[model samples]
Each structure stands twice: as structure tokens, then as C-alpha cells.
Target: MKITNETLATQLNHRSIRAFAKKPIAKEQLTAIYEAARHTSTSQFLQQFSILRITDEAKRKAISEIAKQDYVGGNGELLIFLADLNRNAKIRQHLGQDIARLQTADLFFQAVNDTVLAVQNALLAAESMGLGGVVLGSINNEPKKLVTVLELPQLTYPILGLQLGHPAQSPQLKPRLPLEFTVFDDKYPADFSLAEFKDYDKLVHQYYDLRDTDRRVDEFTTQIGSKKLAAHKSSRDEIMAAIQDQGLCLD
Candidate 1:
């Protein structure tokens, strides 16, 4: 397929990195990545998001527990992005507005979405700069602890963590489902068959992910079908409570 320069290549080759070389990142690159994040668009200019760079060794070690992965503590840079609305709410409250009565799921979603976009922009920027990283949703496991640890104020919650470093291993590009399978016109359709993936699925199924490090991993279908996505109940409950505590009314 015809494509642009590094932009398309970097995005098309996106993959998670578990092993990072023990090298540290230079200050200029770090500054560039954060600058890229700053340019990302926000929701109605509210800018309801914040980023916390974790440079303290003890803190990194503590956060790695939430991820259950040691590489997070080892990566050159570990960052936590947060969805923040409390600051704005406090300002509105000072102006005689009821913060609690004015918040809803949609507002919470907006804050989360803005934070997420900034994270993606940072990821893309890092990739462009020849730095590797992985976004971790696993940190949701200890949202309250995270808030206390980072001393985050009200109306803000950790969205996720990022691990960045030089790549210690070269993993092959894993295949994806056909684009035609997901893209649609004006009206949404759900009755379409999964027929498009017959070949693509086999290609992906044959790929042996390298993270296992010693031998071949499971086939794509087997991995997806047998994966335990339900292993995260505490995270779900706590996140819901965090948002509620932030003055958002989900119900």
C-alpha cells in the first residue's frame, strides 16, 4: 500500500514493548515529547487533563506493583496521565455553581477522552523520535492509592501509565483484521459477516509473539478467545467510585 513517510510507518508498526535497554533518555527528547502532548486538542478548551512524570525510583517501584510488570520500573521514562475536572469545578463552585449537580457521565467521558488523546499524541511523538513506549491500562487497579501517592487533587484520576525506553528486542509486526471489516458509511451495520478475516486471522494466528522470550506463544484466535478479560473487578469498582467522588454522577 502507498503511504506517507515515518508517520504511517510508525503508526502501522505500533507494538507494545516489555523489555527496554537500561539506557536513559536525554532531556531534549523528553522535552519534545511533552511539547507534542501540549499541542493536542482539548474539549471546549477546558483542558481537563494532567500529566505526572514519575522519576523517583521508589515511586516507580510502587507503580510497577499496580502494573504487575517490572519493566515499568526499568523503562527510561514512566508517565501517568490523569483526567482532571475538579480544578475547573472548584473554580465554577467559587462562582456560585453546584459542581456535583452539574456533572454527568458525558462530562466524565469528555475529561477521560481529552486525557487519552493527549496520551496518544505523546505516544506518536515518542515513536517519531525513535523512542519506544507502551501504554498500560493495568494501573487502574489502584486508582485511590495512585491519587494519594501522586497527591492528585479532587476531580482528577489516573487514566493510565506509560513505559518508555530504547527497544531491547525487535518484535515482528503483528497482522490486523481487514480494514473493510470495521469501516462503514453513514449508517451503522452489525449484520456483516466476519468473512473478511479468514485469511488475515490465519496470518495473525500463525504469529508467535516474542514476549514469551523462550518459545512460541498461542495462536491469535486462541489468545483472544481464551484470554481472561474479567480479571479486573477491583479496578472497575474503584474507577467508578473515583469518578463519583470527583463529583460526576453516573446514575
Candidate 2:
């Protein structure tokens, strides 16, 4: 038997909503969403994350261009979740404490975890209220440009972009790998086979994406083996430099 509730149902039925209605989210609802994000558990109670709600038209357009997604600037709310240690660093400095540890790889990952957790909480809150949205990792296509665009201070790095609003289109749910292939025993399984993914690949190839209804997307395994997964020369290649430029010493 399947054990579930309204929250589980909402999570299982999640679909990326690119198009949004012309209506605006109410102030109260937006506040509730923000509160949900703020209340998420952080690393050792150090809330090392900040949410930037982009309302400026020019900035939105610039972000859309950076993401290469038109819908990013079209409608709904754009919130950039940032792994932020700048505020905490300032606090430590004010108290006459050294902020050297704030730049370490450990602290950087902690902030990233805090930021990601907050994002899921905020998205669930919005979805519970009948809103839909998409997580935009494409925002990192030009990491340095994005840093410049947002004027991010030291000890802060962009983690993800979330666009939320009343959904205009209902896209079909994308398929996922079965639990047997993902969930393992206490120790890792000895080995796996490509044949295990055959059925899943067929299912994915059959599902039509709303982005391009004319033709079906590639199979999951095919996509995994494609150039899409290959490292290429792009602004994204300089992501480490960009993060270092922001004074985050990941080493």
C-alpha cells in the first residue's frame, strides 16, 4: 500500500512550469512564502543564505538573457538564492573575531546546503498555495556575468534561481529512475548493468516535453552519453575563478 498525504501528493506531482498567468501573487502569500524560506533549518543555526527578490525590469531582462530563458523575465517572481557568509562575516568582524574560517570549503558547502534547503521549503509553500515554478540552474551559464549583474559582495555566491507564480501551462511529469536503481542497502551494490535502465530510457523517450512538442527528447541514457555532459569552453568554465573572486577560498 502507498502511504501518502497532501504534501507528498504535491511533491510527487511536481512539474516545471515555464509559462505563468498574468496575475500577481498577493503580498500576504509572498510574505508567507518568504517566512517559510526563512524558517528552514540552517547549518548550526547559522543562516548562511540570502534571498534576492528581483523586481527591477532591467535586472530581470538581464537575468533572462543570462539564463537564455525568455520565461524568466516574462511573469511571476524571480528569487535568487545565494550561499551567503558576508553577513555573518560582518557580525564576526564587529565582535573583533577573525573571519578566516568563513572562506573555507567546509563553510562554503554549509552555506550551499542552507540555501538549497531554503529553496525547497519556499517552493513547497508556494505549491501548497496552488502556485507553480521552475528551478533555474541555467542562471549559472554565465556565472561571472551574473555576479556582476547582482553586485554580489564577498563571501556570497549565487546558488540557484527560482521563478514562482500562478502556472499558465500544465506540463507532463518527467520520468525518474526506479528506486531499485537508486536506493541501495547499507553498503553499495557490487555492480549494475545498462540493461537495468532500458525500460526507463524507453519511458523517457516516449514522454513529450512541452518545450518542444514537435519532437520527442532523447532517451535518458542517450542524453547522459551525449555532448551535453561533456565539459566545454564557456563562461561556466570560469565558475571557480568567479567564486574565488568573491573571496570564497574553497581550498
Candidate 3:
């Protein structure tokens, strides 16, 4: 028996929508989505997140280049979610209080959490309203470049980019690891084996990605083993330095 509600259905049917229709989202719907994001739970009642809506074609194109995703700058609403402690720092400066704590790694992590939660809330709200979107972690490929592109202030870092619009394609539902492999009891399993993923690997190999319909993507295990976990450093390697440059103390 499948027990589900509207929210559950929306979540279960989630697909990364890269291609979007030319139609613009209604102002009221956009407002509702923003409101939902604003109302997301914050750590210690400290809302450390900020959302930047990118409408300028030039900026969008620059961000797309940073992400290396053409669809990003094409058509849709582009929103960049940021982990921002600059606002709190300003508040403390105004009160003549110590602003050092705001720059700590602990506070930085809290702000990141706030930003990620807000993005989830915003995406779910949009999905509920019959919209489709994709989360662009790719923007972090060049953190410093992204900071320069957005003119991010001190004590703020870009967490993710969200592209929201009406979906133009219906892609196949991506498969996930079974509960036995993911969900565990109070304590984690004592041991696991790669052999356990054989069935899952087969299922994944059979799946076709909309991006490349000509051939099925590599199996889940192979993808992680070869590509995802491979240590080929790039601009992403400077992420920590970029964060520190933004005035966040990681040490």
C-alpha cells in the first residue's frame, strides 16, 4: 500500500529540470516561493541566508559560464542562495559588539545550513506550484570567480544556484539506493560490501539520461568509483581559500 499526500508526491517525483519553457512564472507565485524560503527554519533564530535573483542577461551568462551549463543562462528565474554572515556582522558593528564570533567556522557552518534549508524550502514551494527547477552546485566549480561575478561581500559565500521555470521535458525518474543500503538502525552497520550494489548497478546501467539519450549512463558504482570520487583537482580545490578570503575563519 502506498500512503502519500500532495507534498510527498511532489517530493517523490522530483527530477532535475535543466530545460525550461519560455513562459515566465507569475509574480504572485514567485512571491509565494520567496515567502516560503524566508520562513524556513533558522539556526538560533539567526537567519544567515540571502537569495539573489539574477535577471540581468550579462550576469546570468557569466554565471552560466562559471557553471558550464548552457541551460542556466537561457530562460527561467535564476536565484543564488548564499550563506551570509555579513548582515549579522553589520548588526554587531552597529551595536558596537564583538563581530569576531560571526566570522568563526561554527557560525559559517550555521549560515551554510540556513542557506541550504532555505533552498530546499524554495524548491519544494516551486514544485508544489507546478514548476520545475534544477539545483546548480556546479556554480562552485570556481568559487573565487563566482564571488567576483556576483560581487559577494565579506562574510558571505555562494551555496547554490537555483534555476526555476516550467519544465520543457519529462525525463525518466532516476533510481536511488534501496532502503537497506541507505537507512540503518540507531547505530550504523558494522560492515558493508561493494558486492551488495551489483543489483543496483544493473538497474542504473539500464537507465537512460535525458541529456544523452543515445547511450545509457555508467552504473552508479562505476560513476562514483571513476568520476565522482576521482581526485582530479581544479578550481574547486581553491574553495577553502576562497571561503577564508571572504573573511570567514576556518581555523
Candidate 4:
């Protein structure tokens, strides 16, 4: 076996390729990607995840409106990962099984964990095949509307959306915060020491976001500082209500 720079090959080459060429992926490969996702290590083998392939033109158009990004639905393959407890909910209901308060936390955590693991497996499978993707959290901006439009059941909730396609542009590798900032030992480290930021800040200030070409991105602190929560509380609250309404606590 020949030793190659596998880690570098994985990390140094990752770029979110939004622009995909006109090539379409084969059905066999699509089946393989879903197969990879199915085999992902799920918590308790509960398999609490669902994937919605938004292939309908009108539906994708409406979803694109919700996401506020035209490119999301315009992609070659757009998938929405979901945390679905609906399967077990119906199973238990039919079996006359009752869930207790103690089981609530377990169900919540398990679904979240299972869905994330499945999404990761799918993403890695795509990357391994040289396909590129971007996970869009913007879908959460209108969770209830997303649920209604997708016709998701009571116990199923959208997690994140993934836009994947053949790489259309080769972009540069973005730098990461140093090891000290990211890699932690047994326990979490103290707040980022004031002195440690200078180097990282300098490194960050050098890069520009392709989302806004020509202008240099603001420094990290400034970006975070500018981050404002919406004046009106929304979908997050609605989703939580939906979660509780799904009968996980047996209330």
C-alpha cells in the first residue's frame, strides 16, 4: 500500500461548489449515496431520519422562496434531511405502548443524533465521489412553513438542506482557526485569552467571502457583533410546539 497525504487530500480540497456544470448524476450513484446514508451508525438503531428529495420544479421553487436563495433549488440535487420520530410514534401507538416523561429526553436526543449521522454519511459519500455540497441552515428560518409545504407529518421536522452537484468551480482552501482555538483536551478551555486573538484575527482579516466578492469580509468579532436575532420570535418556537404536540412525553 502506498502512503499518500490522505488528511490533506480531504481537508485542503474542500470548497462549496454552488455552480454545477450541466452534467447529471447517474441513478446508480444516487442509489449508492442513499445506501451509504442508510448504513450510517444510528443511535439505538432507531433509524430516526428521513430525506426529502425536492425534485418537483414547483415545490423546489416554493422551497427556494422559503430559503431565500435561488441557487438552493436550482441545484442538480437538493435534499432536506429530517429528524423523524413519526415512524416510532405510529409504531408505539399501534402496539399500545406508552412513553413516559423519562423517555422524552432520550427520544429527542436520539432523533437529533440519528439525523445528523445520516446527513454526515451522505455528505461524506458525495465528497468521496468528488461531488460538492453546502448545508443550508436558512431552511430553519421558516420551519413550520417548510413542514407544511413539504407535507411533513406531526413527528417529523426538517433539520437541514443540502445542495449537491458535480464541482463546477475550484476555489481555494479557507484557513481555519489555530489548533489552540479549536482542538481541546479533556475539558473545555477557558475563554479565548485576549492575547491569543491577534494572530487569528490577522489571519481572518486576510480572507474575503466569495458571497460578496471584491469587498474584504469584516473581521470575525465584528461579524459576530453584528449578528442580530430577529425582532419577532418565530419558527423555532413553532417547531418546539410541534415537537411537544407530537406526544413524545406521553403528556
Candidate 5:
């Protein structure tokens, strides 16, 4: 496809903005972003998601502390995206339908897919409007505490935290793996080479080094290996447990 449209250009140059200006986003822009998120396609027309706008300073700060990311709360606007099945549950209850049907892994994954798609659409909308934002996964550091802080009801779980605002800094766009490493044809390739990883790692290391000369940054392979080795210590390791407690029986 030719790079002819403004929308395509905006997406092509997408970058996360952590530092935000004090100025707030205009109401019209906020409305557009929400509309974009709401219009995202859902599985089987099940709109299994909700956007929780965090306006309270105390709550935002508390959330930031939990996430261990100060920029999350200090951003001009904060939104917690949730995979919500509570509304559907309520509807089923009203209609005398079996609530156990919502307890399947399929439905749970559908909610996750719905939430992610909606948030991606919202982020794209924000970028198209010249606004900047970042998706915060750090908020899941303490899922139980986050539930208490947000008071998320049953049949709902926090999926991601999104921060949006006027841009205060313009960081360089990080490198992405080549399409061959990710995108495939009709079927998966049986064998892959490490040549691409080596090339990408060098590029990434250069990017980080140039971006922040004060500190050393590990290469891509090292970073990935480190996380892989510490998989057990991941903050979201208890996700299934939390989901079960939230009444989403994914067994």
C-alpha cells in the first residue's frame, strides 16, 4: 500500500509518550477517543469491556504507586480498561439464563481480546488527534490491591491502564522485529534462524545507547532471556487465581 493518507502516516510514526504536559485534553478529543474505542469490533457482538476514568487525584496517585510508575498518575488523563462480563451476567440473570455459561475460558479470552482491541483503537484515535499516550501494564503489579483501589466489581478485571495528554517529550520510535520474524504466510514456518535476532538486537542496543548515554541497556536477546528466566516472578502470574476470585471460572 502507498503512504498517501494522513491516518497511515500517523500510525507509521506511532510512539509512546511518557512525559505529558500539564494541559488537559479537550472534551471533544476525549469524546472522539471514547467513540473510537466503543466502535471497535467485538467477538459475537459481546462488548465485554468498560473504561474507568480515574479523575480523583488520590486514587490516581494510589494507582501509580501500585504500578510503580509515577507517570501513570501524573499524566493529564488516566483510564483503566477492564474486561467486563458483569453486564452480560446481569442480563443473563434478568432473563433467567444460566450464569455458568460465562465461566468458560473461551468467554474469558474473548473479554481480553475485546478489551485489547478497544484500547488499541482508543490509542490510535489519540495519536491521530496529535495527542500522546502510553499503555500501562505495570498496574498489574498487585492485582488484588488494584481491585481494592478501583473497586472493580465481580465479572470484571483490569486489563490495562492508558494515559493520554499533550506531549511534553518526543522520544525516538523503538525498533520492531522484521515482518519475517512475526508475520507469516498461510502456515507457520517449521524452522527459523537467529540471524534476524542478531541484527535487531544490534539496532535496539544502538537505539537505547544513543537515547540514554548515562546508563547501559541490555541487548534485545538478553532482555528477552532475562524475562523468560524470571517468568515465575511476573506480576500477573496470579491472573487466573484473581480471575477465579472475580467469579470468572476459566477451568
Candidate 6:
């Protein structure tokens, strides 16, 4: 394919930036990124999402601790994206509509999808402007603690944290599976094989082992298998209860 637009190039070269320089992002840049995210599509136009930029140093440090990712607080900005239905719930109360309907599993997943889409837009906007970031799944390590720290309201659930800044390192671009393995035609393929992943596995192995001084130290299969079999952290075990506490009754 022809490298037509710089925007397309930016997306094609995307990589998770873990380390960052100590520079601060300008206010205009942040506003632009937020505006980009605001325009993303939402489920039924619910716009069930919120982005909290962690500005306070102590709070950032505390969240970093909760996430157990020390690099989190060092970014130009740290934003906690939330799947929020609380605003809609309030609107429903005013409109005399049923609030219980929002508690279903469908709404729960839809809100999560909406939140993720907005976050991805923000990431793309930032990256196009030469900014870099990392998504923090580690925030799930202690979701309850995060809720307390952020003081999130009911009907709102923390989905993911994003840390953006001037990149301090340029890691190699990771490999991706071929279209045949991912993109399907009219129907699902009758058969699939683990062996099809072998070639991609070699590429990933080389990427880790040769990219940096501190290598990835494991193959793709090993990584997936280990993560799959790994026990959940104590706090994450109560996820259903926590979601309910946030007023998201996915039952």
C-alpha cells in the first residue's frame, strides 16, 4: 500500500511507550487530544465515558502505587478513562425512565467499548502530535483502591489508565499476525491450527531478544500460557462485587 498520509504512517508505526522524558504537555495540545476523543462514536449516542486527568502529584503517586507501575506518575499527563452511566442514570431519573435497565450485561459491555474507543482516539491524536503513551492494565490490580483514590461516583467504573508524555525510548515495532489468521470472509473457517502461529512467534521472539538490553525473555506461547494460568490478584477476585458497588449490576 502507498504511504499516502502522515496520519496513516503515525498509526502504522504505533508502539507502546513505557519510558518518558520529564517534559510537560502544553495546555492547547491536551485540549486538542480531548476534543479528538470527544468526537468518537458512542453506543446509542449515550457517550457513557469520562476521562480524569490526574494532575495532583500525591494522587498520581498514590495511583502509581495502586497500579504498581512506577512509570505511570512520570508522564506528561495521566488520564483515567471511566465507563460512566451515572450521568445517564440521573437523566433517566429526571425523564421518569427505568434505571434498572442500565444494570444489564449488555449496557455494561457497551459502556466499556465506548470508553475504549474514546481512549484509542485520544492516543492516536497524541501520537500524531509526536506524543507517546502506555495503557495501564495494572490499574485493575486494585480497582477498589483506585475508585477510592479517584472518588469515582456510582454508575461509573474505571476501565483503563493512559499515561502520555514525550517518549524517552523508541522500542522496535512489534509483529502482528497475517490477515488470514485474523480477518475472515463470509463465514468462520472450519479449521484452525496453533501451528499457524509459528512464523509470527519467531518474529516476536526476535523482536524481544534483539531490541533492547533487557530482553523480553520469553516466546509468545510462553507469555500467553503463563498469563492464562496465572492466578488473579486478591483484589481482582472480587470484581463482580466491585462492579456492583459501582452500581453496574451485570447480572
TM for every model, in the order presented, reads 0.87, 0.96, 0.96, 0.86, 0.94, 0.93
Q: Could you give candidate 1's per-residue lDDT for residues 1-251 as a string of tens digits?
A: 77578788889889877788889888998899889888889888888888899988888888888778878778589999988887788889899887763377777788888899999998988888888889989877776776677777666788978888888877776677667766878877767545655676677656764444546655555565663643644565687776666556555
Which sections of candidate 6 miss by over 4 Å? 1-3, 227-234
Top model number, lDDT: 3
By lDDT, is 1 or 4 better?
1
* Global lDDT of each candidate: 0.78, 0.91, 0.91, 0.75, 0.89, 0.88
Tens-digit lDDT track for model 4 on 129-244?
87887777778777667777888766777888888888787766566777887888899975665666777666667765553444767566565556364365665566565556
Report the C-alpha lDDT of model 3 over 126-240, residue by residue, as the tens digit. Answer: 9999899999999999999999999999999999999999999887788899999989889999998999999998888877544355475678888887865777878899999
Stretches off by above 4 angstroms in model 1 are 93-102, 192-196, 209-216, 230-235
Model 6 poorest ten-residue lDDT run? 213-222
lDDT of 2 by residue, 121-149 (tens): 99999999999989989899999999999
Give me the runs in candidate 3 sitting further than 4 Å from their true place: 209-214
The worst-scoring run of ten residues by lDDT in candidate 4 lies at 242-251
**Tens digit per residue, CA lDDT, model 5, 1-251:** 66578888988899989999999899999999999999999999989999999999999999999899879889589999999999999999999898786887789889999999999999999999999999998888888788889998899999999999999998888898879888998999998766658988998898888884336776888887785676377666777788888988666
Comparison by TM-score, 1 against 6, better one: 6
**Candidate 5 stretches greater than 4 Å from native:** 212-214
Displacement of the residue 8 alpha carbon in candidate 3, Å: 0.4
lDDT of 6 at 213: 56
Candidate 2, residue 115: the lDDT equals 98
After superposition on all C-alphas, the RMSD of every candidate to the true structure, in Å, is 2.7, 1.5, 1.5, 3.2, 1.7, 1.8
